[model samples]
Target: MLYKNSICFISFFFLFFFMLINFFFMMFFIMENMVLFLEWEIISFNSMNIVMSILLDWMSLVFMMFVFLISSSVIYYSKSYMLNELNLSRFIILVLLFVFSMILLIISPNMISIFLGWDGLGLVSYCLIIYYQNIKSYNAGMLTALSNRIGDVMILMLISWMMNYGSWNYIFYMEFMKNDYSMKFIGVLVILAAMTKSAQIPFSSWLPAAMAAPTPVSALVHSSTLVTAGIYLLIRFNNLLIDMLALKLLLLLSGLTMFMAGICANYEYDLKKIIALSTLSQLGLMMSILSMGFGDLAFFHLLTHAMFKALLFMCAGMIIHMMNDIQDIRLMGGLSINIPLTSLCLNFSNLSLCGIPFLSGFYSKDVILEMVSMSSLNIMMYYLYYISTGLTVFYTMRLFMYLMISDFNLLSVYNLYDEDYIMIKSMLLLLFMSLISGSFLSWMIFSYPYMIFLSLNMKLMVVYISLLGGMLGLLVSLMNVYSMNKFLMSYNLSFFLTFMWFMPNLSTYVLNYNFLIYGQNLVKFLDMGWGEIYKSQGLFNILKYYSIIYSLYQLNNFKIYLFSFILWMMILLLMLIL
Candidate 1:
């Protein structure tokens, strides 16, 4: 009991301390020229020096404020939500640990520090996901941990490759890359790491599993912190990733995933699952922008998505908390009459999420579509993008209308109007910003002089059409449940259903095969005159499935035992005969 109480006390102190430091530093930076830095004790090895950079920049400062603002509010929101929980102290500790790692990730100047924070963030999120200590939550945590480990390994390999070629310092990597191909290699691997981290397509299953976590955790994981790590990685290395084929591949995968996720979200009836799928779709849009070499546009969308999604999720949390933890949208109806404030905020955030004109999502997402429209990308790629934007609207509105004011006629046995003050305040702040000022932030980050480029009527038409498609979906949602059921049954769309199930898996397959495109690379098989031991099937799937076999065959077995006279003589005889 004392230990638990002490943990609670320390967490409160740290939370207060974090906010105090944020306000003070933000104020000081506003009034000063140089960012204040402090030196701390360091560890060393033989002749290797590691310097910690504890300074702030515009980018780091913005992400820091984002972290502190969201995390502090989440902590406050958790108070009432977790008031009766037994493990509140442990929860608080994990939340604080997450906040610390996020701050460290954004501000750290070196790869070493960035990775330190990266690992910490992953660890804390894994713990939080499994906090309930249930079978399902444990399974989800394990899967997500494994996926994150893959991403971590990619990042580590990239760092190691850099170390082998030159200095592993960030500044040094940047300077050293001006004339080296190694940068391209490292950039490709880094993008792979980002894709896995961002839960882009094939790596996306971990996210829905992550929903097994508490609602506050789902909000943090989906919106601002863990998943967005990939976008940050890309932006941090934009110069290296730009104009590369791998970059284009990333864009394509992101766009396809976004479109696919929207479909899954449409099919979903679970409230949290809907939002979870939408998160994947939103991040896909951002990654698509990144792939298109529009870092500014991607970053802008990321910021907007973070605010609205966070708000939507917290509102979901409040509802779930009040209703004794039911998440099915099918079981919810007429919530607008009971929780007017939360419903209103939910609608506003959903509107932003759907990218209605003048909303936050509209501003950022428009810039991305506009940029892709102007690029030299092929028509098919551009069309995929167009379809994705439309799908975004369909799912966002479907979730909103279904959850906020459906005609399901389900009865609630729990109260829905507690309106805890701290939770309400946190949501209200997010609602105000999302509704009023998120676009202004976009404008600041994405201000580029208008260039006279050819008008992309195709892209523009796609956007309008996609927007209309979403409106059509909303109109359909307004129909009675019987009609919705009839429409679904009449459609009898096995392909769509199968696609929804297979798309995420397909994405993972692509990643495993190194995202190789047909007509780009081919694998060959030769069996040292062994009478065609295995058919050299030209299909990619078969070849990829046999990579291990090919690798083993390539080993230099003779070099393992040169002193074996019989083996050496047979090898020489075979070579002479060949």
Candidate 2:
């Protein structure tokens, strides 16, 4: 209790501090259209320097304020969610470290200092993911850690590549390196690193698995901070990646990721996992937009998405907590009756996620769709984005129907209350932000509005997709109850869509199975066969043979010794005579 109170106080204090700083920075930017770059030398060696620096522009300030705000909210939320846990202090400490790491990454302009935060995020996330001390948590932590390590390794390589420019400060060199063929590999590496951190297609399995963590961690790490690190990194490096071939590949993969995650979320039953997949879908959206050279739009979506996604997770936490830790949505229905406030928050966040007009998600998502429509993208890319957009609405509506409108499916005679003031208080803060963050950020960030000249259909593209998706979602939800039993029973197409086209299986079993089998074979050959023969058994045999020969030569048998000496002397005499 003492520790929880301490954490809550500290979190509120930091929230106030960062909010004030953000206000000042916003005013400063309004007065002068220049970035405030502050640096203090940490270490300097011949041609190798490491300096701690701050890049206080509008982007960093806004993002930092968001991070601090979300961190503070999650910490406050944990006060009730984790009040019963004995090791609450440890959890609070880990959360604090994770937030600090994110702030470090936010301010850094140098690759060397960025690495400090990058690696810190990966390491600390692993600890938080496994805080439950269960096998599931262990497996999830390993998956999350190893997946992020790929990006960390790429960052180290990027640092080495940047060293060729005589400085690790990428902010200063990004524009100059834009056309340098030598820096092309660096750009590719940066994208690959971002893919891993952002949970882009191939690296996506870890994000859902990371739902094994507590809800507060899910809200903070999965929804906002840890996963966004990659997107944030790319935003900082967008100048160099604008014209690279790698960006085209990123666009395609991110589109596929967006579509894939949306389909999977519809199929997922676990409440937290559903929200996790939604985060994956939004991440893909951000990456796809970034690839299209609208990095500001991507960053805008990122900030808005964070506000609501965190609230979404917090609401899910309340549901899970009330349900006695049951996460299956099939067992959850009519929550609006028992927990009306939480239900309202969930519905609001879900609608926002579906890009409902005037909400936080709509501001960025609607603009992104408009921008993509106006671009010269290929037909296939166009379909991927629009289809993914539709799927987002479909899944969100389906989730809302399951948890709110449908009849309560759980056993009767149970308490389901929303009287936890601490949890509700924390959620109310984000709920208010989710309502206004999009328009607020749009007005703050865009001094001149986007020049979105388009045909009528192009202007309404997002609206068309969203309406179509909402209708389909309603049909699917209706089918859940009213369809013929046999028809509903034989849902092969739905099966494919629900399993995310079997991506989770492909990632977890197929990929890892092949590697593990090959690894076992290699271990057998090295540890038991040729390696043993040459390195252990063969050397042992040779040493034994030499020892036996030496022992025989040292034998004190008179007749044997005399015979050996005579034979040696005769051989020497015969050689001399010859």
Candidate 3:
């Protein structure tokens, strides 16, 4: 059963069944508006016990449904995408491992338990990304693993801090210590961990570089599982994080992350990398909205974005297959004529991603934009929010033009086979969901309608900017390569955009890039220079060498030396006796 037949079919049906179960449970809990908490003590000793706790609520149930939905789709799609690969079983196993970790992370409110799931996600993600066994993939995996370890360390520190404060269960403690001044430090540590895990500005390089992984893995990871873990944590901990001073800093950094990713996607040519950047941009939106004290909105966007993003990546994988694994968007076009079904899925998913009207992404993206416009946030935030929204449209339109509307630029003969149907089946599942998941989820999530009051012009601004970004994208894509390069385009700006604000150069494996360099200089100065001179071993070595040289003089007159030594020994004894 494990190897003779299709493992994808088995896992797909299993996860799909549970996803429906979760959806039912989520609806029941929402209707009742109740949460169930269970704790079992395995080893009890004093105040601390080996008891792990589990929380079941509508929120967790909804998240689990989305996770299962996307994961099953990805696994089934991988069946066709990886048909020739020898280790298909291993790939399926890793995806299941990640889902388990994500479920662990979601239901546990204890810091100690969260770390286990958190670390598991990091470990499994690293393994999946480097599944290719190449230099680039290995380096990307290292970056992903090393960057996430910072968040893991933060969680460990939080565990120690919480243990000393009386309980490992954060839910109980957080509810009790809502307004304590001492909770600020905990908030700081928690935000740091979330930022690292979510790939906010400084930690974002790994997300794009992670495109080295197979496209199916990208569909699972970048959509709802790995990157969303941090957003989930923040949502779980919003009680502690709200009204803190660090939240303002988070707002600014998250806005910058959104703006940066949006701009970089337009400049990027790699199809997977463009999608990766879009994920980063959406992550920034979630974090920013969460920082604004709307966990519900963030969670809303998270689920909706997951549906469309997964479908988008799956369609990209299908196209990349048509291009013989060529991810360069410049060499792709007119796919609608060939694979009409895949192209339709890709186009709808892209529109959903662009927040086009009535699509799944629109329900979330529109709410977020309206919320941003209505909030009394600072001017800089307004600029970042609006401009980034426009840039997202720009990059998405540019990618669509390069892939669908432009001429068919593939040099090789394009062919479609029967195995391609496996991918289409899974794609259709997600494709149907992506179209309607947002409205259904938002209706289920909010008890009452959101009240958004704005002038006609303010409402039109979002539409106007989106149209402008789209037109600009079309114009730029239509320009001849030499003409576009020869015009006002500055090579320096292009290079900066290419490298994503030089973040890779700035993010070190150990932690901060600055700290990495600072440590080397510290070692060079203290441990190797002045420290060596005063070290006991150094002084002893120098004295030994000099003593050996002095022994040569003693050899000149051995008897005289012996007599002198004997006299000195006698004199020392006399002085001691006296």
- Ten consecutive residues with minimal summed lDDT in candidate 1? 522-531
CA lDDT, every prediction? 0.75, 0.88, 0.88
- What would the per-residue lDDT of candidate 1 be over residues 49-107, giving only the tens digit for each residue? 56676657545665676666667667766766677778888798788888888878887
The lDDT of model 3 is: 0.88
TM-score for all models, in order of appearance:
0.79, 0.87, 0.87
For residues 401-449, write the lDDT of model 2, one tens digit per residue: 8998898888887799989999999899999999999999898888887
Error of 1 at 539 (Å): 54
Find the number of clashing residue pairs for candidate 3.
Answer: 0
Error of 2 at 281 (Å): 1.1
Residue 414 displacement in candidate 3 (angstroms): 2.8
Give per-residue CA lDDT, model 3, range 352-381, as digits (tens). 988899999999988888898899998999
